[model samples]
Target: MKLSAFADVCLRTLMLLGSRPDQLITTREIAEQIGVPYNHVAKAVLELRNRQAIEVTRGRYGGSQISARGLQLAVGTLMRDLDVRDDVVDCVSETGVACPLIAQCTLRGALRRAREAFYAELDLLRIEDLTGPASRRLLPFPVLR
Candidate 1:
């Protein structure tokens, strides 16, 4: 399943933070590094903070950092937390539209299994895994403010 841009941004933010655990990283910094908009990054960061995946501090010398809790969280869990459910078939839509094949659709089950398998693979990885040496090299050190 294709992750939403929001979820991708959130992961990118976390990966960046994980690289610099000693410093409080700002949303602007994250947006700049990831090439996402500030407002979008801000919203994602807020959600991460609300979920306790990241910690936010206010006032001077305050920014945001990934919490230890976030480091241990499975990537799939984080993705699920950030995902906005998109029904793969009309039968799954909350609109309650009745489908003729609802009683005999094997496709839905197959799709569901495929989606679950995707997340299951991700579940094997933690946030820390994404911040390892190979991945860290992809994210250069952020420029000074």
Candidate 2:
């Protein structure tokens, strides 16, 4: 399954922070490097801070950095937290339309299993995995991985 743009941004933000464990980086810097809007980065930063996945320092020299826990955070858990929508299936849509096969659909179960398997695979990864040589090469700043 393809990840939403917001989720991709969140993961990119984590990777940026993870690549530079010793220094704090600003949202604008992240946006510039990742080629996303500053406002999008800001929103992602705030969400990460709220989830305790990253720490933010507010001041003239304010910036954000990944937390220790965030570095070790399982990709599966992060995905679950960031992709908090229950409408993976058409039957689960918030819209009031009722599907005739809702009571007998095997597709729902299959989809659920597929999603679980996806998460299970993601669980094996950590933020460090994303900040490897390839990521460093792609990012604008010098990432010491």
Candidate 3:
């Protein structure tokens, strides 16, 4: 399943924040790092915030930060949300109808199995796993400003 660019950005931003859990990253900073429009990043950040995947702080130094809850949600979960349902059906419905050989086709059965397997694999992965040790070592230092 293909993930939307916004979703990719969201995951990347979350991972970046996860790497530096002590720092609050602003939307402009995320946009600069990802080479995307700040508005786009803002939208994705908002969506993530709405989902409780990230926390948003409002102030002169307000910024976004990934919450423990967000870190628990895996990349797969985000991808799943971004995936287009039409694409899933497109793989099985070529002409808006079930395969003609539905009664005897093993291919369809196999496709179903493949889809299940895909989701199963995703289920095993968590957001924390994507952050890796490199990010952990880069945690930001506390600042008084």
TM-score for model 3?
0.72
Which ten-residue region of model 3 has the weakest summed lDDT? 136-145
**Which residue window of length 10 is worst by lDDT in model 2?**
136-145
On lDDT, the stronger of 2 and 3 is 2
Rank the candidate models, highest lDDT first.
2, 1, 3
lDDT of 2 by residue, 7-126 (tens): 888888999998888788998899888778888889999989998889999988989999988898999888977777665666744778788778888887888788878988999999
Better of 1 and 2 by TM-score: 2
How much is 22 displaced in model 3, in angstroms? 1.4
> What are the models' TM-scores?
0.86, 0.87, 0.72
Give one digit per residue, the lDDT tens place, for model 1 in 1-145: 7888888888888888887777898888888887778988899899889988899998877889989998888999888767667555567447767787789879888987887788889999999998887887898534322
Q: How accurate is candidate 3 locally (lDDT)?
A: 0.73
* CA RMSD, predictions in order: 4.2, 4.2, 6.7
Winning model by lDDT: 2
